[model samples]
Each structure stands twice: as structure tokens, then as C-alpha cells.
Target: MGFSDGVIIVLGLALFEIISSIDNAVVNADVLLTMSERARKWFLFYGIIIAVFVVRGLLPLLIVWASSPGVGFMGALTATFSNDASVRDIIERQKPILLAGGGLYLVYLFFYWLFVEPKEYAFFFESHIHRKLSFWFYAVASALLLAVVWITIRINPFIAFGAVVGSTAFFITNGFKHNAEQAEKEIAHSKMTDISKILYLELLDTTFSIDGVLGAFAFTISVPLILLGNGLGAFVVRYVTIHGAKTVRKYRFLKNGAMYSIGSLGAIMLAEAMAVHIPVWTPTFITFIVVGLFFWLSARELKAEKIIA
Candidate 1:
């Protein structure tokens, strides 16, 4: 990639990470409210280190290594910047499987929000779908998986297996999130120790980090770029969590924008996995357009509410 292209990809990845983690930031802020000031400071300090370096930095490398073990761990780390054609070939061959898994997870995440998760209705269809189709979420998800696996199995059984693993990861993380929500409620009222609260928050961050890490793949496969963009994004999220959670909550439709961009990226990844041609910049382009549109709508609504008040 050219310098400009690299710059764009990094920016896009950072934007994606920040927007997608807004909810996580909100949750962190809320939980921090229950903790002592000292604990809060610790989390904001040490917690960010773990988040940026361990979760955002290493997770991408781990995913790459896990997907292409033949490349070896160090090889996976430097594979993106390597001049060796053989390493490049290994990565290229593994891209489809990696894309398949991550794509399904993202697509399912979007649908989960649309169908089952409670939210402010950004569009009319969201409310209607939530009310009418919410009960069928499991059925829909199952059928989608069946169809994906059936088609993928014909092309490559390993790809189909990857899709299955992706869906499994989604449900596993989904369960953690659901439990975290319940735990957050409990933590708010109960006399949980500051240390315990810190631990809980760290665990929560890890669960939330999975989404950003996987989504980063859709933006770029370069582990270094992913680490840089996502690390910067993590810092931005921490800042927002500390200072601007309320401001962010006011822009209610921003989450909607994030979800839409996620769904778009999921589609793009799936298409690419199926050997369809997509421009390298398509994910970034779609993300900017979708997010920009929703942000405008959010600002308009916020202004209207302020005027009424």
C-alpha cells in the first residue's frame, strides 16, 4: 500500500474502533461510577495499557497466527510487511477462512441488534423488525448459518468450518455480554470491592475488545496497522469514557451508524471470501458514508431537542 493508502486504512480502522466501542465506553463509565476514585484512576491508567497492548495489539496477531499456524507466530506478526513471496502466499491462502469466520460473526452481531436488542429506533424498520421478527431471531440465525455452511462446504469444507467457528464465537461472546449486563446491574447496587470492580471491568473490556479486533480484520490484515489504529482508538474510547460519556449518549443514532457500517463490512468480507472482487478501500468508503449519514441525523435530532428544551 502507498503511504496515502496506509494513512487512509489506519484512519478508517481507528474510526471504526472508536465508534464500535462507544457502547463499551458507556458501560465502563457507568461501572466506574460505582467504584472509588482510586480504583477509577487505576482502571483508567493500567486498564488502558492492557486494553491497548494486550487486547487490541496482540489479539490481531493471535488471530493471524491461529489461522495460519504454518507461518509461525513471528512470521504471522511480520507477514504483512514481509517481502517473502512464500509468507505472502500462505497469508493469501488463509484470508478466505479468516474472512469467513469474522464476516459471519459481524453479520450476526448486526442482526442481533436489529432483531433482539432494545434500542432507540434509528429507522422505522428497526422498531418494526424488533417487534415483529424478534422472536424468530434464533430461527433466522440458524437458517442463515445452515445456508452459509451448505454453500461453503461445496466450495471448501474448511471454509465452512471457519464459518461455524465464527458463529460459535458470536454466541459465546453474546452470552458473555448478556451476563455482563446482568452483572453490571448487580455491581451497581451491591457493595463490590474496588479490586473486584476493576477485575470485572477488565473482563468486560476483553469481551468487548473481541468485536473491535475481529472487525479490524475487515479493514486491514496488517497486524501492525491494526494495532496502531485500534490502540489509538482504544485511547480515544478511554478518554470519552472518562469525560464524554454523557455527550456521546446524546448522539443516540451513532450506535445505529456503527451497526450499519458493521453490517456493510460483514457483507464485504463475505463477498471477498467467496472470491468476489472488492476494492481494497470499499470497507473504509462504506463506513465513512454510513457513519457520516447517521451522525448528521443524530446532530439534527439533538439540535431539535435542545431547541424544544
Candidate 2:
């Protein structure tokens, strides 16, 4: 890829990561309010290293390496940048499985938010779906999984398995997230030590970071680029957690924007995995447009609310 293209992709990945994790940042900010200054400082200082290098960096590398074990860990790391056709071919062969798994996970995430999670409605259909179909989230998820697997299995059984893995991942992480929400509430209200809260926050951060890391694939398959983009995003989230979480919370429709961008990315990934062609820059541009539109709506809503109050 050219330097300009790489720059755009990285910027897209970073923006997507930042917006997607706004909820996590808000939660982190809430818990930090209960901690000592020293504790907050330690978490912010050391936590960034873990969040950036360890979680954001290592997770994608691990995903690539695990998917393409033939490409040694180092090989997988450099494969995207490598000019060697053989190396590129190996990565190409494995890309669909990786994309399939990650795509299903992402699509499921979007649907869960639309059907089950409570939110300030961004569109009329969102509220209608939640009110009437919330209980059918599981049924919808199951049917979606079945359909994806049945379609992919005829073409490639492994791709089908990858979709199953993705669904499994969604359930496992969703359970953890539900539990973490309860934990965060209890920790916030209790006499938990600063050290304990910090550890809990770190764990929570890791869980949340998974969404961004997986979504990063929709932008590019390059591991180094993923690291750079996601690393920058993690820093932004930390900064917002410290300085701008309240300001961010006021723009409520931003979450709607993030979820919709996620669904778009998921569709892009799934289509690519099915041998359809998409421009390398498609994910990046689509994300920018979707997020930008929702941000405008949010700003308008905030302005109207202030005038009323």
C-alpha cells in the first residue's frame, strides 16, 4: 500500500476504536472517581502500556498467528508488509476464516445492541425493535448463525466453523460483559481498595478492547497497522476517561453511530470473505461517513435540549 493509503487506514482504525470504546471509557471514568489520585495515576500510566502493547497489539498478532500457524508468529506479523508472494499467498488463504469469525462476532454485537440493549433511539426502528423483539435476541442470533454456517459450509467447512467460533466468542464475551457491568456497580459503591479497583479496571479494559481489536480487521489485515491504529485509539480513550468523559456522554447518539459503523464493517468483512470484492479503502470511508452523520445529529439534539432547559 502507498503511504497515503496506509495513513488513511490507520486513521480510520483509530477513529473506529475510539468511538466503539466510548462506553468503556465512561465506565472507567466512573470507577476512577472513587480511587485515590495515586491509584488513578498508576492505572493511567501503567495501564496504557498494557492496553496498547499487550491487549491491542498482542491480540491481533495472536489472532493472525493462531489463524495461520504456518506463518510463524513473526511471519504473521510481517506478512502484510512482506513482498514475498508465497507469504502473501498463505495469508490470503487464511484471510477468509479470520474474516468470517470476526465478521460474525461483529454482526452479532450490532444486533444485540439493536434488539436487546437499552439505548436512546437513534432511529424509529431501533426503539421499535427493542420494545417488541428484545426477548427474541437469542432466537434471531441463533437463526443468523445457522444461516451463515449453512451457506459457508458448502463452500468451505472451515469457514463455517469459523462462523461458529465467532458466535461462541460473542456469547462468552457477552456473558463477561454482563457480569462486569454488575461488578463495576458493586465496586463503585463499595469500600474496594484502590489496588483492587485498578485490577478490576484493567480486566474490564481488556474485555472491552476485544471489540476494537476484532473490528480493526475490517480496516486492514496488516498487523502492524492494526497495532498502530488501535494503540492510538487506546490512548485517546484513556485521555477521554480522564478529561472528557462527561462531555462525551452528553453526545448520546454517538453510541448509535458507533454501533452502525460496526454493522457496516461486519457486512464488509462478511462480503469479502464470500469472495466479493471491496475496495481496500471502503471500510475507512464508510466509517467516517457514518460516524460523521451521527455526530451531527447528536450535536443538533444537544443544542435543542439546552434551548428547552
Candidate 3:
């Protein structure tokens, strides 16, 4: 039970981590390309080390510990180390709150993309729906999720508190991340060292990771499995960041798949928060299914074009 099941859980968790972080990988790749070659190498090395060891490794432990209901931080830590069940018990109790916060953040991200400034970017959404704010459409998605969040809150006050906090944090973080991106753009033109760019990448990583780590609870609550799986996945995500731009270019639809995958993962988190039973493997297959459909359509379009030619 321990060995075989452990292996499956680990692999599943790793895939989830990869799926969740592709957008981050793409953004990181964009940043890395601007740096000098030597600096890029060192930055990636240290970035992976910190992202996995510090962020992926320790952060989950701290979350489980700190978020554990009644126990103080140190007490929770002691429980986590001494008794695994205690960690699981605490997390299970708080799962709704964690899920609510993570899901709302993702919903906010998706709506912000579609609604905030439609003219700046061309999205499929703008062609179909005409509006002043486009935010009303965002409401369609948010309203249902908010309803679920509200229901979850009645059962668990922690979940309500979490959702409110999550919404506020999302608003603040989005602006903060925007500023970071702007600062990065300015630095690209300045005499700043490659170190500056590297630091920016790491900070940028921290923001995305909040959702990734929190969403991880939907899969498994075991700290070692979470760390090992997420650590391995983070390593691959960094590799993908370094070499991913071309891949994304080659299959344009997959980029959309990555984005959709994020939004779907967020929804799943919220549903689970509301006591909806979803399988752990739901994310892995849903992503493949969405991207696969697009891949097939793209291929058919190419073949048809060739025939016409």
C-alpha cells in the first residue's frame, strides 16, 4: 500500500504541479531570455534550488502547520513531525478555506484577463461579446463560484474568512505583479545586473506559487509527497521555462490549453471547497482532453489548407 500507492500519488502530484505552473514557466522563460548567458545559468540553478527547497519544500509544511486549526504554529509543527494524522486532520478541516482562497484568486486572474482592458489585447472573448467593462461577463463566472463560497462559509467560518481574504489578496497581488512586470521592463533598458532580473524572476515565481501550493491540497496532504512531487515538477517547470518558448510557438493552441488548465484547476479547487467530490486525477485528464481537442482541430485545419493549396 505504501510503496505502490505512494509512487502513483507522487507521479500524479508532480503532473498537477507541472500543469499548474506552465504559465509561470512561460513568464520565467521570457525573463530569462533577456539576461546574459552566464547569469542565466546561475540564476536558473539558484532559482530552482530556492523554488523547490525553500518554496515547494518548506512552504507546504508551514502552510499545513500554520493553518492547522486549534494548535499554535510550533504545536502544529510538532504534531506534523510527531503525528502525520494530526497534520492530515488539521488540513482536512481547513480544506474548504484553502480551496476557496486559491479558487477565487484563479477566478480573479481569469476575469482580470478577459475584463480589465479588452482593447490592449485581442482575445476570443472580445470578438464574441461586446461590452463596456466586459466585467459583467466575468460576473457570470464569479457569481456561481461566490455562491458556492457563501454556502461553504455557513458550514465553516474559516472558509468565509478565507474567501474574503483571498479576494483582497488577489486584487493587491495582481497590481503588485503588474508593477513587478513594469519594473522588469524598465530594468531591461537599464544597467542593472543580471542579478536584478534573476531576483525579479524569483519574486514573480513566489506569487504564482501561492495558488499552485494551495491547490495542491486537492491532491494529497502528505508533506513528503507534496514536496517530493512538487519539487520534481518544479525542476521540470524550470527546464521548460528555459526551453519552452519554442514549444509554445510550435503548438499555439497549447498556450490556450495552459491558460484554461489554470482556470479549470481553480474551479476544481472551489468545487472541492464546497464539498463537491472530484477525483484527484480530474485535472490531469481534463487538461489533456482540452488541449487534445485543439490539437486535433489545428491539424485538420492544416491538412485542409494543404489540400486547398
The prediction achieving the highest lDDT against the true structure is: 2
Candidate 3 lDDT over residue span 192-228, tens digit each? 6788778877877776677667656656666677788
lDDT of 1 by residue, 1-309 (tens): 788778888888989999999987887788888888998899889998999988888888889888888989878767755677788789889988899999999999999999999988888999999999899888988998898888888888888888999999999889888888778657767788999888888888888788888888888888888988898888899999989999999998999998998888987877777888887788888888998999999999999999999
Ranking by TM-score: 2, 1, 3
The better candidate by TM-score, 1 or 2, is 2
Better of 2 and 3 by lDDT: 2
lDDT of 2 by residue, 157-252 (tens): 988888899999999999889898778767877898999999988888888878888899998888889989988988899999999999999998
Candidate 3 colliding pairs: none
Candidate 3 Cα RMSD (Å): 3.8
> How does candidate 3 score on lDDT?
0.69
True-structure Cα RMSD, model 1: 1.8
lDDT of each: 0.87, 0.89, 0.69
With a 3 Å backbone cut-off (N, CA, C), the pairs that clash in candidate 1 are none
**Which regions of candidate 3 deviate over 4 angstroms?**
1-9, 78-82, 116-126, 129-133, 137-146, 294-309
Clashes of each: 0, 0, 0
lDDT of 1 at 212: 83
Better of 1 and 2 by lDDT: 2
TM-score of 3: 0.80
Q: Clashing residue pairs in candidate 2, if any?
A: none
RMSD of each: 1.8, 1.6, 3.8
| Model 2: CA > 4 A from native | 72-74, 77-85
